[model samples]
Structures are given as C-alpha cells and as structure tokens.
Target chain A: MTDPTALSCPAPAAETERVLLGHGSGGRLMAELLRDVIATELGTDPIAEDAAVVDTGTAEVVTSTDSFVVTPRFFPGGDIGSLAVHGTINDLAMRGARPVALTLAYIVEEGLPLDELRAITASAARAAATAGVPIVTGDTKVVQRGAADGVYVTTTGIGVRHPDATPSAAHGRPGDLVLLSGPIALHGTAILSARESLGFESEIASDSRPLHALVAAMLDAGGPDVHTLRDPTRGGLASALNELAETSSIGVDITEDAVPVPPLAAAACELLGLDPLHVANEGCLVAFVAPTAAEAVLHAMHTRPEGAGARVIGSLTDEHPGRVHMRTMLGGVRVVDMLVGEQLPRIC
Target chain B: MTDPTALSCPAPAAETERVLLGHGSGGRLMAELLRDVIATELGTDPIAEDAAVVDTGTAEVVTSTDSFVVTPRFFPGGDIGSLAVHGTINDLAMRGARPVALTLAYIVEEGLPLDELRAITASAARAAATAGVPIVTGDTKVVQRGAADGVYVTTTGIGVRHPDATPSAAHGRPGDLVLLSGPIALHGTAILSARESLGFESEIASDSRPLHALVAAMLDAGGPDVHTLRDPTRGGLASALNELAETSSIGVDITEDAVPVPPLAAAACELLGLDPLHVANEGCLVAFVAPTAAEAVLHAMHTRPEGAGARVIGSLTDEHPGRVHMRTMLGGVRVVDMLVGEQLPRIC
Candidate 1:
C-alpha cells in the first residue's frame, strides 16, 4: 500500500529527463522547477521574495542566502568573494533590513592555488568590513580534483527589519510607479566580455556593490509607501518585473526609452544578440512606490552614488493583470516575458 | 611600496602549492589551510566552536551554516537531505539553543535526475518537520556537468539560546566528567561501506539524527553545569577532543573500555584498519559536565532514545593541557592525536 503522506512526485518530461543548464538560469525553466518540484515538497512558495522574514518572538529578523558560482572567479570589477558578500547583502536590503552578520561556507576543489584562495578571502573580508557586517562563523570543505570547480561560496545573512518598512512584491498596487535604481546590464556584460575574451572597447566593469545604505535612504524617504523592492539579478530586469506583476496581480507598463541602459552595455548587448533588459545587474534595484512618495524617493536615491542614475521607467496598471508590456521607442507595444532558458550560465 | 591595508598573504610552499583532498578532511591538513590561508585573510578564528552566538538586542541568537556534499546522496539510514538538516540542528544544539528556523540553498549539477532532486527535497522537508524547525527561505543554482558532483546543500540555522545554559568548549575545567551520548564510528563506516562497496555482513547504518531534544534533556537535568557540548563530526572524537583541550587549556583522559562502540561498527572498522575513535559520527555528542551533576545528566540522557547508550567515557585533568590520552583496554595509556589528512571525504 502506498503511504498517503508520502509525496507523489511526477516524473520528468522526456525532454527534461535530466536537469539542464537552463534550470538554474533564474528564468522560466527555473521557475517551473521551483513550482513543480521544490515548492510542492517544501510547502512554501519560493518565488515570492528574495529573503524570508521571521518573527523571533522578541524581534523580527530577515534572512537571505545565495550561492556564488560565477566562472573566472575574478572579473573586471569584483571577484567571486566580494560578489558573494554583496549578493546576500543586496537581498537583505531589498527587504528593508539592516544586515547584521553573515556566515560563509566554502567548497574548495583540490589543487586550487593557496594564493588565489588568500586573495578571495581578503577581498571578501574587505567587502564585509566596508558594509559593516562581520562574518561571524564559517565552514570549509575540500573536494577531490575534478569533483568540483575551483571554489564555490555560499553565504547566509541575518538582519533586522526596518521598523516602518513592509515592502513586498505582493504589495504593489495599480497606481504605484516603478523606479530603476541605476543602469542595467553592466555586470553581466562585463563578466561575459571577460569570459569570452570579446575585447569590447570601453572596459565595461561590473556594478557589484552592497545596496543597504541606498535602501536605508529610500526607506527613510518613502516610509510605508515603498510597495516593492527587487534586484534584477540572474534573469535580470524582465524577470523581476514579471515576478512583481504576477505576485501583485497587476500589470506593468514600462517605457523602453525611459529605462536607463549605459551606452556601452547597450551596444555590447546588441552586438552579442542579447536583450539588455534580460541581462543581469549585480548592484541595481527596481522599486515600486506610491505616486505620492515616488518623487521624494527618487530624489533621495539620487543622492547616493549607487543610485545616482535612478529614474521612473514604468507604472503598474489594472488593465492586464499579471503581465508586463513594454512601450517600445518606436511607439509600439510588446510583451516582455521572462527568459526561457539559460542565457549566461554561472554568471553569479 | 606595499598597500598598507592590503592583506600580507604568504606564498604557498613548494610541497603544498595546491589544495589537496586532505584539506577538506576535517583533519590536520584542513587545520593548516584554515590557519595559513582562510583565518589570516578573514581575520577571524574559524575553529573555536560549531556555532557563533550573537546578541540580537532582545535575545541571544545562535547561528550555524554548513555545506553538505556527502557522495552517493542516499545511504542505509539517511540521505544527504536529512543529514543537511540534522547537521545544522546539531551545531545549534551543541551550543544549548532551541533551533527555530533554517535556510536551505542548493548547488546542483546539470544532468541530475529530477526524481533524485524531488526525493532530496521531500526528505529535507520531512526532516525539518520532525525537528520542529521550518525551512523558511532557500535558493537554488545549477552548475554545468563536472563542475559539481551532483548536488551540494548548504543549510543555515538560527536558534534562541536557553537562558540558563552557558555551554562552551572553553568552559571545561579539571575534574569535569566526560560523557559520550552514544556509540561512535557507525556513520563513517556506513558511508565508507556504501562508497567502497565493501560487503560488510551487518548493515551499519549512518547515525544521522537531530540531537536537539537530547541536548534539551541534558540541559534540564544539569543546567549551568553542562560545561561543554560538541558533536563528534568530520574528524570525529579525537579531533573534537583535541579542539576542546586547546580551547579550554585542559587535558582529557578517556578509558577505551568505557567508550560505547557498537560491535558491528567495531568489526567493520577493524576490517578496514581504521580507528573507531577517529571515525566520524553524526548523531553522537561528547559533553563535559561538572562532577557533581554528571550522574544526573547521564541519567537524563539515557531516558532519551537517541542517548540510550550514553556512558561516562572520560574526565578532564590539568596534567597535560591541549592533549588527549586514552587508557587502553590492556591498561596502557596511549596518546590520541588529531587525524593528519583525509580519512573520509564528504562523509557529512
């Protein structure tokens, strides 16, 4: 007799008998994997937010974790070490939390140079110090050569939620204005350039940085009016906006001309047959704010170096719920769907 | 002209130019790598304890993170899923805390079976439910084939410390009684048997179980007198004892005859020419208790199923600080040193 309590997992489709690289691309396939497999068993919705907020009886705590597997380890602007710190920090910031401490665990492959490991750790430490968050504890494990890549870092962060902040993707309302924190695609373009040896001029560097301070400023300015905050990471801006739309049951109308895309990144994306909106951004955020507080939040964001290029690129609407539409520069409308599969694998 | 703030990293020695498989064995080589590379660059000691306790203003919070890369995924008793959950819970329990929440992250390799992934998630969820802790948040990433073995799960846990409990490795003092919660070597031998296809007659299952409930019982029986608690993992009892000695500046003298080693595990270890003392255990813990309260704690521990085989294995002394000696069954005293290199890789 089959146990009723045992989960009856469906077999993978013929096309997906085994996991493909696309399943980790933070795109449509990844979403399907989470919805069909992980979420059904774990009993929690995984796509709702970047961090989980838990009440610890005495105080509300927010926790976020990410694994860094970016190839090349070292890039034009930041190494894997710093990227690991900034990634989790940014996740906490998106939830309007003050990150307190972090735990780092490393899986190093056999035969990795000690000098390289030192450089990575030092860079990580410096990033933590700059963000004022100490790495309190850590674990190290080594795998045999050929069993693992050079190194993989997994970092988890603990933070205290801002008192007046209740930002969430589900909180976006029809009248909210969507804001872009800065230019997109720089981080992804830089990594791809380095990996492919594209020799692109202008030396586009990754915008890898911690965004907690900028988040603090916006929270201070908008208070409870900030409806949603998200970083356009793996699947990038299009994925983030579509997620917000689905979660809030609202429609997003973004103007292509209003989106901030650096000329270098835009050109690189065009040449590489990539969509800038679908390319990842390491140190940028997209915010949905009440129209009344949108101007003030944008002004506050502009005061910070990380958010100097902040702009209002879209607005939520009730016409087409759970969808995102882009107003092209040529005055035509187009649906902006989530990327279907892996575009750039191991790009943080 | 050296940059003042740049970390002064030493070059790798000729014989150790690259990381070896031994570096992740939780043995001597791992310690050297930590001391010479990781600790110096991160600017924090990584070997002091299992979990790092932090003051959260309202209450004390204990946090621990571990990356699980156990090969074969499934074993006789438990899978990597339950092991990941139990491992972090044990770390929290070692510090006398009540584990409240957990975060799970996965790094999967391409081509992994979806059925395997589903089984792992279901097992992990069941483990978390059994332990009364919720996996509150999670992240999943995929690496290309050969970049990762199959799947690596990293779990981070948060728990609230008991008000009356102040257990620490540094708190062990002379005359404290050393207690072993249960039999040793079962977990390591089970993994080895599965990995090497060794046809041992008895199925020595891995003793992977959550130890929080047992720990709570010990605390209740001997609050404020449970000097220290440590799970015998990775480098097993010998490494754990050496670490406690170094941290407490005390010596431990254990009686080999008094220690609990299941006959099946002993036979298997003997067959493989491995020391049961240095073999890893997942469910067992070693505790240092004040002499006056030792009997009460042991009695309390025995009442629990997980600790049914509890025994007084040793006592602390001031004779040789930072050393461990075992009174052999033949009435001869022998020194027990930490394992020098890889004994069993990815055991937990």
Candidate 2:
C-alpha cells in the first residue's frame, strides 16, 4: 500500500520560488531537463534505448545510480520524476549502450503527501513506458519531515554499449561542424519567469523534454558524422559549446540569425538582463558533425519531431582554437564566453 | 589558465531557511549533506571496484562516472577534491572493479582566487595518488559569479569490476548478520562542530578516510557470503539497517550495548540533540554476512587496520520483516526507523 503522506503533494503556484518535490516529480520537466543540459554535457558515451543490454550473456550486470536534487523540480513543462529516468537512461546511452533495465530508488520526506508521490510514480511509469523502458525494480524510504525536502530519486540504468559507436565527450575534433537540434534558453526562462517573481511573459514555457528518440534518429541518420551529441543545460548554451570547443581545441562560430530563440524568450531575457544564449534549454541538442556530413546530419535532425527546430547554430573554426564566437543580428561579431556560473540554480 | 578569482569563492553566510547551490559544491559538505542522508534513507545500491566489468573479456570494459558537490570544499578531515576521488573509487570498488582512469571536470566561478583552486587541484592529485587512481582527462569552465558557488567537480570513473564475485546491494539475505566497520558519527560530528560559528569540538575528527582498501580486504576474505556491502554514510547506522531490513524482508535487532559510540561523540550528540546513529559518517561500512559466515566476516573486518573497531551491530530475523529493532542499555526495545529529515545541512 502507498503511504498516505507520500501521495499527496501540493502544487505551488507559478513564480513562488516555493518549489515542492513535485517539480522533480519526474513527470515531464525532469526528462526535459535531462534532454536540455546533461545530455549536452555528456556528449556521448554508450547508451541504451529504454533499457541497455549488457550482453555479457551470463554475467550479472553492474549498475551505478544517481539522483537529481535540483530545486524547482517542477517547472514549466516537466518535473523530477521523468528527469530521473531520462538522466539515468542518458547516462547509459553515453556509454554507447542500449539500456536494458533501470532500477528506481526514491527518498521521500515524511509529509510529502502520498498523492504527490503517486503522481510522480505514475509519471515515472508513464515515461518508462513511453521510452519502452521498464523500471523493473525499485525501493522507497521516508525521511523525517525536515530531513528531506520532498523527494529525491536515484536510478541505476544498465545497458550494453554497441560495438559500432565509441562515443564520448572526449572525442570531438577541430574540423567538426556544430549543429543544434533546436533553440536555446527556453527551459531556463520558462521556469524563472513561471515563478511570478520575474513577472515577464512571452508565452515562454520550459523546453524540458525527452530526446532519446532524437538521439536514436541522429545516431541512425548521421552515424559517422555524429561524432558527438550533447544537450545544453545548466550552464546553458555557452557552457556546452565551450566544452566542445575546448575539447576539440577548435574555434566555433555561429550565426545569430540561424539560432532559434522564441520571441517570448528574447523579450524575457532583455527584461531580466539575462543572455538568451546563456539561458538553459531542456529539449535541444548540439552535435559535432563531420564537416563533410554536416548537411546530411542537419537533415536527420530536422526529420525528427523533437528536432524540428534543427539549425546550424555554429561550426568549428581553426583561427581561434578553444574559442567560441557569434555573429550578432546587428551584423557585428561578439565573443561568446563560456558560462561562469549557473543562471538558475536547480532549474533542472 | 585558471581565473584569478578561480578559487576565491566567498559569500557572507546567508540565514535562509531553504537550500542553495552551495550545498552541492564539492568544496566540502555537499556529499555529506545530501548523499549521507540519501544513503541512510535508501541504503546501498550495488558497488563495484576497479572497472565495472562483466566478462566483457578482452574487448569491452565497464566504466562509470559521478560528480561530487559537497559544500565548504574543505572540512575537518578532507575536502571535496579528495571526497570526489574516494567516492568515484568506492563506486568502482563496489563493482569489484579496479579503477584505471578518471576524467575530472570543474566548473569554477569567475574571479575565484587562483590559490584556492590550486589547493583543491593539489588535493585532487593527492587523493588520486593515494587511491592509486589517476586523473587522465579533465575539463574546466568558468561560470559567471553567481552561476556557481566557488567550484564544483564532476569526476567520471572508469573501472573494471571484480571477476570472481559479482556483488550488489540486492544480494542481502534473510539470515545475514550486519557488521559495522568502526565507530560511527565521527565524520558527521567533526564536520558540524568544527564550523567557525559552531565552535564546539571534542577532538571529533571526521572519519572521512577511503574504504576501498577495507572493501578490497573484505572481498579477499569473505567473497559471496558477504551478501551485500555498503558504506553507511550520510544517513548513519540506523538508516542503513532499515534499508537492509526492508530489502531482505528480514528483521534486524541491534543491541545498543553492541553499537560503539565514541565518548566525545556521545557528548556532542547530547549537546546537539542529534542521535549518533542518524548522523553522517564518511568512512564506515555495514557488511551483511550470512549466518554461517558471520563470524568469519567479522574476523576479517577486524583484521584490517581500518576495521579495528569492527563490531557485530545486529542480525537478521524472521519476525518484524523490514523493520529494525534496537535494544537500549536500559533493556528496553525501540524501533530503529529510517532517517527522516536532514540532520546537518552542509555536513560532508
């Protein structure tokens, strides 16, 4: 039987900064958050689809687990529950493995309210189902009232890396073309303004979403050109791009006109004095494509529903190694520095 | 090049009721504050040493990664830098894998002092050297002032799991005897009391030593009968026991007389009004042994220099499934429930 307190989670009104565990509810935002930031940071590892198969045939697979404790688990479109699954699944994916199974673990505070937990569980189940991934195993424990905020989830995803893809964030190159599956900053702005404190509106919503399907689409479509794929998150666009640029010892240049920033987000950024490019986005991806296959890879990204907003935000350049630059809409150039801090703490 | 302010992370301590990102900074207490409580609440997942390999043979290998964000960076016995290495190494150890390489990623705040970061890096080097693990690859980025606390480290450990015995947290059984490696609460108490403001000390240093050696020794001595092994960290002894009870569908009865509480720790707890069992301990283990092999396991645990204080904390029983009972010194019995709330917020 479900604990009564575990299920009844309250919904804090938008813009309160008074986030509850429901935000990390693993509903939608969690997945979106993973899709946005962590995936970008991961670049590539072997990953499993919904579940990964460690084809050791007879060996019992070993798995490591983690939890997302970012505040404001619930943001514009998603929560923590879905984030947990995607995050785990993506971790397995980075290993270039097919995820075979996931073990879910949750730590809920005493007064979290049972309904909220049930909602999170339901969301987790739904996400796992959508990804065709099954939770398979789980454990739950309750912390005293003040010990935990609401709920924190840890998942261990076990998968078998594919033989063909030796993916890793460490393996980018100077000649690669940087491709973005979509826009930037929507996720961060959506959550920040949603709090009612920022009080800016452009119909901005969090881009928190799942990108396994898009990942699969990219892997299949771009294969060799898809040297590395990552989702820009916490430190947002600047951090993600900087990592890739530094790793490859390459310079990156993007056209501002080509990068998609929703009208609402652009306006919101000006009001809050935040750089839209530096804001976090959940569902977008940045890919390092082989220069020769850049066009084909862009086509593949555009083909996927998740990648419909696909565009070439930037490309590798040789002149300024380990540097990133952008052409402003004003037709002038600006040096895009790596993010020095998180724009929004625990937006994920 | 590191930023001039790369390590100068300082902000007047805030008097807020809720949490902030500093709690996740690897600087000091993030792990103790979060992982400790979370672990106590959830217990152990599986563990691997070296690399998480599973007969992948000469071709494929098992690898895992993690990030540590304990606040304070520097604490009584250790810092976030060393803790990160220990954590990654322990994770590999849990898989019975030998750690080969690590990728260290740092997100530093702009204007952080160079000396502080240099010290942290040196500590990381020291930790890696002590653990016999090397940092082969690394990535560093600077965030704007408020984007990051001071510095955060994310280390991805690559390891090969042990061959003979495949251990996991799921392996605990009904008749297993629970053994604690040594005195508890040292790590937790020392960190909290050592704070400048708290200014209370009983020469209670944190037990923040690495446990791979102890675990390695245990693996050599006990093998399979040591059904499950876990380091009872943030959540302390009570929470770990509760997890075992629930997972193994068994009851655990621990004699208060049998549990060791250091004299100073007792006094500190009395003053703090915190239970020693519920406090965090960075360096300790709770080993589950089969009834027939319990004595052998304890003998082996006590054999190690680190395990000199090893003791039989409890045993599994058929009644009160998933519940833990403790016999008080007064001969009264009480339920030892899971840790409910956060004991000390920024204690690692």
Cα lDDT of model 2 by residue, A85-181, tens digit: 7765654554344566665555455556545665666667666777776555443433344545566665655555454554455557767777888
Cα lDDT tens digits for candidate 1, B189-266: 998888888885247899999999999999999998999999988777887798788778999999999888888889
lDDT string for model 1 (A112-192, tens) is: 765566677778878988998877666666677777788899999888777788788678999999999999999989988
| DockQ scores for all predicted structures | 0.11, 0.09
Interface Cα RMSD of candidate 1: 15.3
**Model 1: number of clashes?**
0
Error of 2 at B262 (Å): 3.6
